[model samples]
Target chain A: MKIRTLALATAAGVALATALPVAASAQDAIYVPLFTYRTGAFAGSGIPIANGMSDYLNMLNERDGGIGGVKLLIEECETGYDTKKGVECYEQVKGKNPVITSPYSTGITLQLIPKAAVDKIPMLSMAYGLSASADGNIFPWIFNPPATYWDGASVFIKHVADKEGGLDKLKGKKIGLIHLDAPFGKEPITLLEKLAKDYGFELKLYPVAAAEMQNQSALWLGVRRDRPDWIYLQGWGAMNPTAVKEAAKVNFPMEKLVGVWWAGGDDDARAGADQAKGYKSLSFHAAGAEFPVIKDIQKFVVEKGKSQVDKAKVGENLYNRGVYNSMLIAEAIRNAQKITGKKAVTGEDVRRGMESLEISEARLKELGMEGFAAPVKISCSDHNGHHKVYVASWDGQKWTKGSDWMEPMKDKVRPLLEEAAKDYADKNAGWPKRTEACDKAS
Target chain B: MDILYKIFIDPFMQMGAAPDLLVQALWEGLVGGVLYALIALGFVLIFKASGVFNFAQGIMMVFAALTLVGLYEWMARHGVPAPAAIALVLTIGVMYVLAVSIEKFVLRPLVNQPDIILFMATFGLTFVLVGLGELIFGGEPKQMITEQLWLPKGSIDMKILGGLVSLQKIDIAAAVIASAMVAGLAVFFQSTRIGRALRAVADDHQAALSVGISLNQIWVIVWFTAGIVALATGIMWGARSDVSFALEIIALKALPVLILGGFTSIPGAIVGGLIIGVGEKLGEFYWGPLLGGGIESWLAYFIALAFLLFRPQGLFGEKIIERI
Candidate 1:
C-alpha cells in the first residue's frame, strides 16, 4: 500500500510541476515578480502595498495596454516578510527574466544587494535600503530613490526643530526614538544619534522586540518615564496600532508622537480613534484618491473587478505609496525601453534606466501623477533623488498635509552618507566602481 | 565609577525619585503578566492532558480571534446584529470541530509516536493553520469588536503617589475574566468526572486506557478546553491591540512562563507569568538603558534559566519517575 501510494504521489507531483510552466509561458508579457507579504505580522502594512503594485500594473495592462505596447505580467510570490522566504522568492523569480526586483524587506535587500551585482539585475529598494546604497558609485545595480533613512532622520529632526522654534531650541531637549528591534528599525539610529549630538538634544531609545510588537507595556513605561519632548516611532504593521493604542493608554500627547512614512497608514491612526486625531506621520506622496492617476486606477483596475483591492482602499496612504511604488516601476520600464530602444529590455538595460531616471514635475504631469508623487530625479552619482517629504496629520477623519515639502539638512547628512558609503565599500573590498553610468546624462 | 553609578545607583534613585512611575510600571507589568498567564494556561492545559507539545497554540489563538472578528465583521456588513453574529460564531461549535479534527487527523494517526514526533506534528499543524488562517482572514489587522462584545473602552485615571496612573477598563475586565477562568478551570480539573479521566490519562496513557478511560474523548475535551482558553486570551489580547498574526510572537512569551511553571501546573503558569512579566518590565525600564536597552526579549529566558538551575523540575513540576 505504501509503494502504491508513493507511486501515485510521485506521478501527481511530476504532472503538476510540468503543467505550471506551460501555463506561465502562454502569457507573452514583461514579467515583474513581486516579493509581497500578504500575510504575517507585517501584513497589515504589506497588504495595501502589494494591492497597489498589483492594481497599478494591472491597470497599465487594462488602461494603457501595458507600458511600451508590451503587457505587464506580475507573478506575485508571497514572502510574509521572512528573509528566508524572501530569498526563496528571489531565487524562484530571478530565473524568469524579470526586468527588476523590488525586495520589500531590508534584510532581503541586504542579501539581494551582493546578488544583484552578480545577477546584473537592477534592484529597487525604494525609500528603504542601506543608507549607503544611495552612493551609487560603489553600488551600481541597486537603487533607493526619493529618500533614505538618513534623509528621514534629518527630516524628522528638521520637523522637530521647526516645532521647537529653531535648531538652537533643540538644545537640551530630549527626543525618544521608540523603534522595532530589526535592521529596518535600526536604520535611523546612527544618524539620529549623530544629529542629537550635533544639535545637543538628548536621545533616548526604546527598542521593541519583533516578537513583542503587540506586547509593549514596558516600552511605554520607559517612554512615560523618559518623558521626551517628542517620540518618533520606527514601527510597522500591528506594531504601529499597538504603539498608538499604548500611547493613548498612557496619555502620551498624541500630536507629539511622530511616525516615519512607513508608519503612516490610515488604519494605524484609527486604532486609537478620537484620541489619535492629532497623530502625525511622514509622507513622501500625497494621500487621498483625488489625483487623476488614482481615479484612473479606480475606474480601470479596482472598479472593473480586475484588481483584488477594495474600492474604498484605492487611495489610502500605504495604498497610494504602493501606487507610487508601482508608478516608479512603470517609469523605470519606460525609461529602460527608451534608453535601450527595445520594447522589452533586459535587467542590465533597466539598471542603466534606473541610474538615469528624469522624473521631473512635467513628466509626472504627463504620467497623470503630478500631485500624487514627489518629483524625483535619479542619477548614477546620487540614487536618492529629491529628498523632499511632507508631514501628514490625522484629524480623526483623514490625513491632511501638515507641512510643506521640507528638504532634509543635506549639509549635515551628506558628509555622514559619504563616510558610511566609503566604510561600506572598504568592508566589501573590490566593490564595483561606477565608470560608465556616472558619465552619462539622462 | 560613573558607569556603575548609572547602572545600579541611578535606576534605584530614579525609582525612588518617582514612586508614581514605579507604581505605573508595576501596574503595566501586572496587566502584561495576566495576558502572559492566559496564554501559558492554554499550553499548560494541553501539556498536562496530552504531553504533545502543541507548537500551534499561538496560531490557534490568532485563528480563533480572527474567526470571531471576521464572522462579526461579515455579519455586520450583511446587516445582521452584533449579538446575533456573536451568538452564531460562539454557538457554531468551532472549537469542538477544531478539537475533533486535531484529535482525529493529528493525534489518532500519530498515536504512540515518539514525543518529538508529536511535537514536530504540531509544527506541521502550525504551518497548516497559518496558511489556512491567512487564506480566510486576508492578513490585514482588524480592530477587536470592543463595543459589540460589550468590552469597555477608555481608561480610569487614578491620582496617587503625586501623579496620575491611567489604567484601561478593558485591562481590568481582562484581569477579572482571566482570574475567573483560572478559578473555573481549577474546579473543573478537581471535581469533574471527565476531568478526572483527563488527569488519569495525563498520569499514564496506557494505564488509563487499561482502566477504561477513552484517550480520544479525553483528548477532545482537553483540546476544547485549550481552545476556550485561547478564545478568552484572544479576546483580551485583541482588545489590547489590533488582531493580526504578528500577535502570535507574543505567545512565545508563554513558553518561558510554561518553563518556569513546569508546563503541568495551572497555578504555576499564573505565578510564572506574573514573575516573568514583572521582571521583564522592571529590567527593561530600569536596567535596559545601561545594557543598550531592549533587554525585555531575553530577560524572561534568563530569569527562567536562573530559576531552572535551582529547580530543574520547575516551580510546581512533578518529579520524573526516572529521576526518582
Candidate 2:
C-alpha cells in the first residue's frame, strides 16, 4: 500500500512538471522561440550572439512593458550549434505557438526549412542559410536578409577587380579559396567558380574538413606552393583562427587574404596577435559599442546584472550581429500587430510582416540605429534585399571600416538563385506550393 | 604511364625543385609529431598499469589546460601577484586531486571488472570533464599564457636553398620540453622504488596485491603522471592554436600513432609519432592535390592500417605468446 502511494506521488510530480509550462505560455504574449547555442566547440562564436539576442528582447520587456502592450515571451532553447539538437529544439518549441525562429546555424536552418512551411512558423536565417532561399516564390516560409553568400562572393571579386584596376586585369591572375568542408563553407564555391570562368582567372581550391580544422599544416603548405595572388577564406569557429595563424606562418600577406563575414569575429583575428593587423573581412553591419542602441542596452539590461555578457564585450562584432537579428524580430512583431489589428499575433501574422518587411533610412534613424547597417527592404518575391556591404579590417586591437559600400552583382546572382530554388523544390517529392497570398497583394 | 610518372616521379621532382619547402614541411611535421607523442604518452601510462583504454585522455588534456587558464584569469581578476606562477602550482594540485578522486570513485569500486567496463567508465569520465570544464571556464576560446609562462615567441627565419623557412620559437621550446619530460619519466620508471612497484603491479595485479603492494596507491600515481603529461600536451597544442574544446578533436590523431608504435612501448610512441606526422605532411603536400587535397586527415590512418596488416604487434610492441 505504501509503495503504491509513493508511485502515485511520483506520477503526480511528473505531470505537474509537464503541465506548468503550458499554463505559463497561455498568458497574453507573443511567443518567440530562439534556437540559440551557448555550448560546444563553436560556443566561442555562439555565446556572444546568444547574449545579444536575448538581452535585446529582455530589454524591450523591461523598458516598454512589451510591444503593443502585449509582453514578448522570448524563450531560448540551446542547440550547441548541432543540427540534431537544433531540430529537436524546433520540435520542442513548435507547440508553444512561436511567432518565429532564428536558427543560427546554416545546417540547422536547412533542417528547419521544410518544417517551417508545414508548421506555419517563419524562420529568419539572417545572412547565413541556403542562399537559394532568397527566392520567396518557392520558399515562402524561409527568409535570408541583408545579403546572401553569393552576394558576399560577388562583392569580394569586385573588390579584387577594383584593386587591380579593372575586370580585364583579372586575366591570368591566380585566386585561391580555403574553405571548411561543410555546407556552410561550401556555399560560395559555385559563385566563385562562375566568377573565375567569367573573369579568366585561374582558381585554386583548398578544402579543410571540420575534424582537421585545428591542424592545417598541409593546407598552408599547398598555399605556399601554389602562391595564389589572392586568397578568400570561408571558415567558421576554430577554423578561422587556425587559418589566420597558418597564413602568418606561411608569410602570406595578410592584406591579400580576406574572410567571409562569418569568419570576421574579433577572437578569430586576435588569435594571430600582432601578425593579424591587416586581415580583412566582409561585413553587412557596423561593429563596436558606439551606437546609441548599444548604450541603451548597456543601461537597461547589462548594468542591471541580468545579462551574461562581460561589460567589455558589448560592441563586439558577433554581439552587434545578435542585436541586429533581434531588431528584425522586434520590427517584424510590431509590423505583425499593426497589420492584424491585434496585440497578440500568431506565427502566420509575423509571416506576413516578414514578407512585407521594410527598414528604411528614416526608420533606422528613428530606431537610434542610423548608419548602423544598410536599409533592408523585403518584398513579396525577393526576401534577401541584396543590399550593399563594406569591408572591415582588423588593426591588431579592433576592427575599423576598410572600404566604402559596394553593391553585389545582381545581374549574375538572381538567375542562379532562382534556378537553385526551383531545383530544391523539384527534388522534394511532396514539396508544397505557395498558396498564401502575398501581404502587398492582400 | 602518365599515372605512374605522376605518382612516382613528379613528387620527387617537385621536392628536388623546392628543397626549402621540403625542409619546412619536415620541421613542421617533427613539431607536430612531438605533440602527438606527448598525448600518446598519457594514454600509454594509464593503459600500461590499469589495462583500461582511458578514452578520456583527450578531454583530460583539454580540461587540464582550461583549468590552468581559468585559474590564472580568476587570480588576475582578484589582483593576485605572480598570478601565472601561483596558478600553475594550484593547477598541479587540482590535477592531483582529480587523479586521486578518479582512482577512488571511478576505478576502485569497479576493481577486477572486465576491461570493456572500465573502458566505458572512461568514456563517461570524458563527458563529465567536458561539462565540468565548460561550466567552470565557460565555452569561449582563451589565449594560452605563453608569455607569462616565459615561453619564447616569434620565429627563426632562415634564408637557405633559394627560399625562406620560418621555425616558430615556441615550437622549438615545445620540442625541448617534451624531450626533457620523456627523459624524466624514463628515469622515474626505471630507477625509483615506486616505479619498480608500479612495474610489479602492471606485471600481475593479483600477485602485487598478494605481495603487499597497494593497488589503489599505484593507480593514483599512474593517473597523476598521466595528468602531468596531459597538461604538457595541452599547453603546447594550445599555444599552436587557441585553447578551446576544439582541441579535443586533435587528440584522436594520437590513436594512429599508438597503433603504429606499440601501445605498451614508450620509445615506440615517439618514433611512431614522427613517422606518421612526417609521412602525412609529405603525402598531403606532394600528392594530395591530384586527389583534390585534404588527405592529411586520413593518410595517418592509412599508414597505421598498413602497419597493422604486416606487423600486428606494432613496431616495438611485445609479441603476445600465450601457451594454450
Off by over 4 Å in 1: A1-28, A439-441, B84-92
Q: Over the true interface residues, superposed, what is the Cα RMSD of model 1? A: 1.0
How do all models score by TM-score?
0.96, 0.97
Residue-level error in angstroms, candidate 1, position A3: 15
The lDDT, on a scale of 0 to 1, for candidate 2 is 0.90
| C-alpha lDDT of residue B34 in model 1 | 85
Tell me, by DockQ, which candidate is best. 1
Report the C-alpha displacement of residue B204, candidate 2, in angstroms.
2.8
Candidate 1 — what's its lDDT? 0.86
Each model's TM-score for chain A is: 0.94, 0.97
How high is the lDDT of residue B286 in model 1? 89
Whole-model Cα lDDT of every candidate shown, in order: 0.86, 0.90
